[model samples]
Target chain A: MGKRSFNILDVTLRDGSHAVKHSFTEEQVRQVARGLDQAGVRYFEVSHGDGLGGSSLQYGLSAVDEMKLIEAAVDECEQAEVSVLLLPGIGVKEDLEDAVKAGAKMVRVATHVTEADVARQQIELGRNLGLKTIGFLMMAHMAPVDKLIEQAKLFESYGAEVVYVTDSAGALMPHEVKERVSALKDHLSCEVGFHGHNNLSLAMANTIAAVEAGAAYVDGSLRCLGAGSGNTQTEVMAAVFERLGYQTGIDLYKVMDVANDVVAKIMPRPQEITGSSLIMGYSGVYSSFLLHTHDAAKKFGVDERSILIELGKMQAVGGQEDLIYEVAADISKRNKALV
Target chain B: MGKRSFNILDVTLRDGSHAVKHSFTEEQVRQVARGLDQAGVRYFEVSHGDGLGGSSLQYGLSAVDEMKLIEAAVDECEQAEVSVLLLPGIGVKEDLEDAVKAGAKMVRVATHVTEADVARQQIELGRNLGLKTIGFLMMAHMAPVDKLIEQAKLFESYGAEVVYVTDSAGALMPHEVKERVSALKDHLSCEVGFHGHNNLSLAMANTIAAVEAGAAYVDGSLRCLGAGSGNTQTEVMAAVFERLGYQTGIDLYKVMDVANDVVAKIMPRPQEITGSSLIMGYSGVYSSFLLHTHDAAKKFGVDERSILIELGKMQAVGGQEDLIYEVAADISKRNKALV
Candidate 1:
């Protein structure tokens, strides 16, 4: 709200709900919305339905109650503003107008790196509706820096308030973030933002790298919930900002408590993988193995054979819906027998 | 081996077994040994029992039977020679001689960056036994490049056959790898080698960067099995070599098969993290969020919320671990439950 204009945008009722079925109740959204408001997060993404009818990726999950969303937008962020993101091939002019009327002060428009030009119309559309538009290129690193600069500038020129760099694929390294953010600052006359995917496990690092490299706004889901590896964690960024000598006006403990309650109510923690997990992520490789190693080890004596057998079959294990414990139990059974 | 000496060092029994526990069978080692020898990797690091005898953080996982290692070494590798790694605080002159008589052709003397002078004695001692000695640093990045040069020069004066530029932290970006390796190259007349961690999910990238930066011998474990996040995947490096038009004498499909089989039998495939993983690893920041987010997602229900929660607990999630699935699960679970 001040000179720097930093805001924590919670998306528990938005992006995170996508993982389940976009089936969040009005009550859950209301609680999270109020938490975000109380914790001083200035903005919230009211799911796609709040603007567009529904999301293209995760169908049925959108802000249908425009009035409720606006109320939360106004109430959850009494001191701050609310931001909504729109995807092309989804939201039309009518939806844009509806979003503005719903109290979305800022609108983020995202497109593929190659399709930034298409978002030009959306940015202009958002501006004409009296909403500040943030231009975003999903999978920013899919294209080169020069190309990214060209695209970011294109959106910024067309009434885009900020050029948002989105690492959708989670494929970029930190230096890439620095190099690109700097290039955006140097080339574009608009504030730059960063949204990262956890695929590379560097979402927080990249977010820090971006902010350090001059990104004004950082977009992370409440608990870093979104597609693939998920988005950056807003709460983490708040701490990062705090540590770097900036008073973000974020009641970090308050925000964190709300975030934990929401996230724990929403989901359990993920397996902390190393070695092969990292390699697979780095190589753009996939084969399962998630958190199976430790569980399998606990079950099957932790022998090389057991480990390899688990490794070989992890591809089968990963896509198996919610079988982490059973796999561990199975392996532990064998391990116990061995002992 | 040619002037550049493309030696395929099989530390699978050493480094690889560490990841899978000191669980290597005489048969498993022999199986890999015979295959690696047949495939024509240059050097075989005779199993030092996964570095168990070597205690400090300096020597990782030393527990393969040395005599059996020599027996396996002598029987399997027809053309590929042998090398045993020497840790300063662990082994004596007697161990090196025993290794030599046991038919080890070379020995690598390892030390921390501050202990390069310490390796001079070990290097000289190993050299006297008709062994081609290499000086290795465990955490090479802890020291500056100038210090690295100093270490290399000292080791070179002690008749070290190669001066290895190790990024034990997996901390170096590609550029840094090039800079450090080249700096070491400039200071020493001996060949340069490199070993890196996968903390940043850049083990393969950094190793490739090192090789491209003029590291003659690349140090990697089969299936990338080793301490912490583990070493680079030798098969991946072999693929890099093949692509670069270098003769690695590696059967890509064969190596892949063995690697796959080995991992399948003894270990889980490492988690596949994408861009964020590399960035965090490169930035050298630690946060448990990466691992927790992914796992917490599954534990909770909403991948997004878990990601946010973990990201929110940035201080709490202070080191890299695998969490791709955890993030996805949290987001999805919350979405389903709340929706």
Candidate 2:
């Protein structure tokens, strides 16, 4: 195997939005973007955690307009290219156009692993607009290697420059990640990337496995400031990459300072594997289901873990959050009967 | 390779003593010990964080007599056998004898990787006292494969039933752990065990790697309650082992309940990879140096990371904690001169 070069995409402004309930102010975006840019990071993703136009009643509202946050990050970045994430149903073409107007140079069009066709229009539009178009298959672990390759190929055919195997549930083990990433590398014409969550405390290890299996682009957030237990921590990933003999072009000391000084201040709490999050990972449930599961568990008087495990058994996907209530109510009813 | 059967040793009452400042009351020990025993964990280690007789002004005093805590654990446990750790310099033979009287069925004689000779007397005494003698080589990352084998051989020759490749610093990556554990497994006659810390957030991954490399006995603390980001979490490790097809003989839900209901209440704070602890793992410094580094940094007005890095460069061992202050003072003096 040849040595593979990897790019670190700082997702603190994008995926991290979920951890903070989409409450990043424009100034916070500017601070994190500027610090990461100065620390030699080449890519900064800025958007609502769900995607562009994701701020609404259903998915928590953004504190500041996401367009303005994008503009702030784009303005603060001197060397880094700003990126935006867009899921087809959550974010529309207008949101992508506005993001481009706000100076986003790349757009990662995200869809469920088996639903790549929904993102075709956005991938084509991103290519036409001269932005770096990347296909992001969320919950990639839900599909087998062949299915992942088939979906990734669809993205490449739709003009995506890169394709990512996204572990939204943080459920895939290191060997599983390697197998998926290697399959994509073998089958996809476009560059392969990986986005990992730390719900199972394997984000760093899974990212390493992806890189070793030929992933060229990977995602991280400062201090793991994403959803659930958050993404792979950006500063620690840089340090680990350096130790692993990967040239990430990130200044280790500068990134560490940014994580500790800038990002740590705005974080509501340190990202950790709480019981709910651990159960989410163990049950292979969606990362965003954490709060919903907790709420349903409380409202229905059921254990949050039982709800998550039931969802996993049902093979629930990202958009199936309504099932949380169903699962909780069902568990509560069963327990009452037992009593 | 054939199927591997692994045993998890819950160290919540032993290494976790460090995270709580040796403050486990007798009742708390009984609760955790009984819960784990009921959950089918076969081994429970109870002692001061530093080892037997380690409670002192230097290592911090135990909240209750360790002998009583051991007795409490022994009294509560129906299936699990209580174990105690004895570092030769901190815990002498008399302490081992007392621990045996308190119903400790096993004694892990700990010494630095290069100083296993110091633990020979303790190992022999434990064996003679009808205890299962295990040799614990702490800070094993500081030595190469040959040195580790040489030291582990000393323990086997001293009548140890098992030898451990202990990552006390939490510095070794998964591949590095695989190398060390495989080396020990290949060279040693006795069974090999692994003890890990989560300083770099790789405890779970490193422990997995050790198991893959043929380690049979592994250590974990409930909720990762130990020094410097704590050890591999016992509940989480059991979950992962189940996923990996390893029969750990641990009931997952029961262990999770023990962690959440019994152990979580006693945790002062969640074990996390703080900036100081992250730097410790990155710099390969001792896990116990976190508090001292923070104190020295505050006193001398130096960055804790700098002190840790300097200590890593000097290859400082466990007993050389005074160097924390010395390094801090040197950095402070140099900074002042430049100013």
Candidate 3:
């Protein structure tokens, strides 16, 4: 086997914010950042779970300003670069500038898979600021291979340094991941990456598939601390990559220590594939919809699975949270009529 | 895209016995069996975790006699066949006869990957008793593909109906599993099967790889209720098989209900890849070595990871429980000398 080399982008502070409801304190961010930096992590993402400017009532307010959190991580890291995730509509030009000022050296401009055109301006802005710019195509499973290739090419044309097949719903099988990532690697000149969630317990496998298909960069979090069933566990990924003869440049023992001693302590609950999250993957709904669907289900006294299934049928994507309530209400109304 | 079909042999009562310390009560057995049978599970294995006659001072004692538990499952199941696992030395010819008398219609004669010859007598005995005989090559990761094929061929020649590439250590990667199972499928006349452990978090992926490589029978436990981090979750496998266009003959909703309603409640703790278990997978130690290693580590005041790594270096396989203590004591003595 070839000694394949790749980069590990740790997203614990950014994507993990959703697990803690965007309430990561400065000290916690600094501790995790410092630990991962010592473990030889090359890139560390820090932001609101939904990205910059995502701390409002709907997305849940941040305990500390994301700029402060990013600065905290930046102050702790010696070798690792701090990064941020910026969804197109939620995070505007000023937010990107502010993130760069807070010492974020990379920015992943994320968009719904079908709407890569919306990320063009932000991708160019990130490059202008001299940040390593990446275009993240979220919910990559919903689109066909050709559509993904087209979107990835758009990212490459916009001067993005890398494009990712982000399995936002954790709905993809390994072969599907291979097909989509292989197509992007073939069609685009920029490096390809993959971001995975564990809603269906396939995050590690899908990330392995992405690497096998020539992904140059991949996303993981300490203890799998992300949305839904969380992202792939960073330490486990480091161990597996080492076993597979991939050059991740990560100290496996150090990463494992960080995961156990630092990140595991702060987690509210161990991230397992719960019934709602499993339904999310099975139905192709967005990962972040988990909490909202639970609340809606409880309020309407309806099953969460029904709400998720209806949303899946409607082909819901991220930021379409209002549909959760609508689906729940409809189910509740039908239940009352039956009664 | 082809609609491939495979048999899902539920081993919750057998392998899951390890998680519960061989303490499955008769009622619990009946409940799980009835639930899975109602959900259309084709085969249900019931025995001590280490197979028949495994309950002793060395291996934890069974809460109830396994024969009684097997009879309980047999009574509850209407369509699902009751199966039992029998390791040749631990379970002699008499245990197979007893299992058959207790209504077990199938028996998997298990052995170390290099010791398949030991199962020849038990395999023949199972056939004579009108049992669906399966030859289980435990720790198949320790052997090369050609070696695995040769051993599987021996099982086929001995009249075993199926031969399994059993990853008792949870050590094989997806590609490795594919190679071994594909080789057996090509060379053997009998059906090929796969049994996976989730110590490395690759059970589902490895099982999928095995199925892709022409395995006709696959093993899973409800809610991943087996050894180490557990086996592949049965309900999740059913959902994934459905998503991958594979015919599992399982009702997805029914299986999910059984997992959530029946199995989850009985589990002492949720089976996530813990630190010790992760080391087991990383070091290629047997999955069942988890609790024994933990006990040895505590008694010797040594690190569990060190014990597991030493075991891996020695290439320890199943039924090597004594080695865990030996490794732990050696590390303890070395530490004392340094002090």
Model 2 docking tier (incorrect/acceptable/medium/high) = medium
Better of 2 and 3 by DockQ: 2
Clashing pairs in 2: none
Give the better candidate number (1 or 3) by lDDT: 3
Comparison by TM-score, 1 against 3, better one: 3
Model 2 Cα lDDT, one tens digit per residue, B175-221: 99999999988888899999999877789899999999999899998
What is the C-alpha lDDT profile of model 3 across A230-302, one tens digit per residue? Answer: 9998988988888898888998778888898888889998887767677878999875677899999999999
> Which digits, one per residue and each the tens of the lDDT, describe model 1 over residues A130-232?
8878897775765779999989888988889898887765556667888999999999888998877665456666776787788887777655655554667
**Model 2 / residue A336 / CA error / Å:** 10
> What C-alpha lDDT, on a 0 to 100 scale, does residue A291 get in candidate 1?
48
Model 2 per-residue lDDT tens digits across residues A302-336: 87888888898788986788989988999999999
Alpha-carbon lDDT, every model:
0.64, 0.90, 0.90
- For model 2, the superposed segments whose C-alpha errors exceed 4 Å read A1-3, A287-307, A318-339, B287-304, B318-339
* TM-score of chain B as predicted in candidate 3: 0.91
Worst 10 residues of 1 chain B by lDDT: B271-280
